[model samples]
Target: MGDVTTIRRDVLTLPVADVGPDNPLPPLCPPDEIHRPDERDGEGLPRDMARQIGYGRLRSLLPERLRDGYGRSRAPRAVDTLVIENDRLRATVLPGYGGRVVSLVHKPGDRELLYRNPVFQPADFALNGAWFSGGIEWNTGATGHSTLACAPVHAARVTAPDGGDMLRLWEWERLRDLPFQVDLWLPDGSDFLYAGVRVRNPHERAVPLYWWSNTAVPEDRRVLAPADEAWHFGPERRLRRVPVPVHGGTDRTYPRRSEYPADHFYELPDGRRRWMAAVDADGRGLVQTSTDVLRGRKLFVWGTGSGGRRWQQWLTEPGTEGYCEIQAGLARTQLEHVRLEGESEVAWLEAYGPLTADAGTVHGTDWAAACSDVEERLERRLPRAGFEEAYKAWRTAADTEPGELLATGSGWGALEVLRAGHSLPGTPFDESALGDAQAPWQDLLRSGSLPEPRRAGPPGETLVAPHWRDLLETAPAHPHTEYHLGVAQWHAGDRAQAVRSWERALGLAPSQWPLLRCLAVADLEAGHRERAADRYTDAFDDLCRERRDDGEAWTAATAALGREAVAALLAVGRTAPARSVWERLRPATRRRGRFRLIEAELLLAEGDRDAARAVFDAGFEVADLREGAEAVGALWSRITDEPLPERYDFRMRPSGGGGA
Candidate 1:
């Protein structure tokens, strides 16, 4: 080897919008799913696609809390990064932030192959919330961005096939309860950066699997994939088959041509090489190609319209460049999930590098010729046989034990290993990784009961998996056990049992809000608005008293609970008490942008449109305002709308219509 590949520890200092503490409350199953299995599936569906259209049917987000507590305010912070480089290419991986490959540089031309964000700004884009845009993201567990989008992953140096170092990232994805790992290495003198991903379903029963490697490239490029047609899901939220490149009057292959945001999943043929690329006017750009196991290719464009443009600006500093996502997934589309067999794993390899094709050919009006040119270039660069050999080599080296622990992720993986004795050879979840969060659950495993209340902050997060539920059920009956057991039961769809367990827990304890909040949610769902408000009011008051002297963790908890309580009271037409709860909030907490919006809503409920408009006029950005949420626009329309102010227009879909 002329130039030895290197893996080193590094830091990237940037203005990072803090991803604040997670909400302490649990989110139950929605009354109905956005897509139902019984509904006639989208036309030309693939096998098992219909079944997976509703993979989240009857789903609950219990163990994972919503992370909507981030803001636009950012300060310089040193984010830890792992750098793996060869003479030709340099790859920077953020192991602390979901193992996201934050940057890839092609050294020959000194070109950045990815659109690296200038700032680490958190927004309401992830499944559990607080997601930042840029780089190559590992999307797993569901249709939306992974719960691990901003969370860490276990990382360590492992042996490469050529005996050099490789960075391996592994984590237990809680939403689907599976362990997955990604191995990244660069061969000596190779320009391509290779990533090998493995997702293991350790359960005895089969489970749905979702994996997508999302790569972001500059928006001002022509994207090409090996297909003549695509499954287009637009802001209108309807799926239809359309011609590649040009649809309607413009060519969407260039991301900015469209007026609204959309996803175009390329309809690759039965045996086409799996790849996606974005080539610039000079026909030089990044190309991401994966092994056959990773079959899907897609392009997500945030159109050049106001909302889309605003969203692009929102994810980074104002002057930073914009980007579009060229993604590869296990299924034909992100809307579908593949069925993974029990105790089995799916593994694939992906290569990302610079692609320089003929500018005229790639930018030509003939879509077929453009795609063929890129595909032929890709074949010349990385032959299918060579790619297959590399995959096989990676498979053989996958089992090599990690040499050094570089970074540690969540303790849930180790907790799972201790609970079920999962023998994941390549990716080890060492017991040392277990920390404070997992301590109570580990004690439950060891001593058959939870540890005493660790001071009256918000209740330690609850686990609602079936196995954890069984343990909770067997633990001696007490307020703590009953409270957690209720959460478990609720997750299992046993509504009556869950309510009774919570009631018993409240009976055993003196007005704990954790238990009360769950009961309040149940009441709200059951059309008991007044009763829900009553419970919510009591819960807010109790939490205020309990977390009086606690710090920011409790501060986050109080803010979350207070918001919920106010919303419940307002829904029940009890503005007086809602105002009371709002007043009781910490001044700083009430001043948050989210709370400002809530205050505006409350003022509007009190028939004070001028006050509500003033709240809007004073100019506050709900930093974590949800994607596609009409909350801001709806309030603007109600408060004497002047065309829904362009500054606050974050709408992705068409306005003035029913939307999901």
Candidate 2:
């Protein structure tokens, strides 16, 4: 490593807005639609009955990427690549390609240290639908490839505090309506590229969000991270956590030898170290290190010869080329749930550099071996101060608050933290990431003193301050801000403007059920019965997209939508669809008992008291429902004007309500 302390920046030509039709970029193709077995089998029935009815079903059919050519080629073909180079390394940034670090070259050998995909291929692969793999991708906002992946960001070359060249990339994430930035600094004489990241929720309400820095490398490398166990989706898509590298006494780490395609997420055993590496067959590769804020380390390998590899290659290119990812995240894996507090920002730093170790020394499951390799490559053992120094550097550079540095662990330790009611860093942000502030007014209109706009307004007579428009103007792409604007416009007697705002919001965050539901309510108020029914149906479908394991959200959706949905289906003589709703809502009771009440109510409404009693008994077997059953029984008694028999402990009561 050189000792000079200067920095330099080289800016390339600016990227063009759109590629010409004659360009060699791959033709855009729509992703294959997701079709469940039942849906596929329903094809023989009448058109209405042939379609599966659910929020998830409807959402799965909605087009993810826009069909127009302009939307398909939204990302520019030519990028204004920025180069931050020093004597030891050169890092290139593609500001147009999601501000990705497209290349990290080891200056000595003039060889690429990170995987550089030969072609710039964007496909419908990310959660928001478009994604491109390779180099270091800043995945912020939610899981998958992030909204910015393959999209342009605001980038500039700046001077670091240490007088080094820094490349800063940032953009507003429209889905979550938040601002985030990544600053890359490579000192004149250093081998590593240091990255500082900040995600801010300017509003008083906090939102859920996920972030990760995904670095891709050639598949011939072996990953060495501090982990004793690995979690992956096993048979039947069930998550199974087993010993790392070897599951069921079978080596499962490398791609060349695996029988089937496997996605392995290792639980980082040492959060204090905050580092992981991928060493190639030549004993040379890259080392990724970060502050405690970026504690999670993940390794993903697509089998050398498998269906998964073919599927991925089909999107990138048809070839034998394979790659693996070494990701640094704020949680155990990138998919874990995380929340950002209102008016708070999360800041962290990470580094990537070339590393060389003795051949055959890398071991994926052994933490000691991995640390030894890092020590050998760096020529220094990381002492306690090493960790503290990194933390101090991140804190000082980002001007972060001490209280905001969450004291958490990695891997299972993070899982334990989540189980304890505290948010883990880098987890997937969900709709509930808004903390407790679900109301759009609290997020957009409230000035900390004003009353929230009521839904049952004097029929669209609620007042909105002029500043609220300014907020919307500043965050034009924010779905929540747009939603609030729509409500305010409706109240101010601007129904057309309200619909336009809502339509825009829906386009940005199609799965946000509240937005869909609100739109439906507005339609109903305007006597647009067909539009209202369609919006309500879309809202219900959107709610189904929530992971079933999220019991609170799942149950809440079922409780809010189930009764009306079931009644409507039954009223139309759609018993099968009504039964399906009950079955779909059944899993909600496994973790929480709220949905059990809905099931009981549905049964009782159908004049099946015996079945309702049976449902309650079964619900108790699945979850602890003492409190829920008591509440449900009380509601039932009031609604039916019937007093319950004494000594009836719903938790321990006999099935069929003691042979009532």
Q: Please report the candidate that would top TM-score against the real structure.
A: 1
Per-residue C-alpha lDDT of model 2 across residues 421-519, encoded as one tens digit per residue: 333233222232232223443443334332333431111111232344445555445665566566656544566887788788777663466666667
Candidate 1 structure quality by residue, lDDT tens digits, 314-358: 888778888999999987778887889999999999999999999
In model 2, what lDDT does residue 238 have?
34
C-alpha lDDT values of all predictions: 0.86, 0.55
What is the C-alpha local distance difference test score of candidate 1?
0.86
Could you tally the backbone clashes for each prediction? 0, 9
Enumerate residue pairs that collide in model 1.
none
Off by over 4 Å in 1: 30-47, 56-58, 656-660
Clashing pairs in 2: 55-541, 207-433, 208-433, 209-429, 330-425, 336-427, 336-428, 337-427, 338-427
Sliding window of 10 residues with minimal summed lDDT for model 1? 31-40
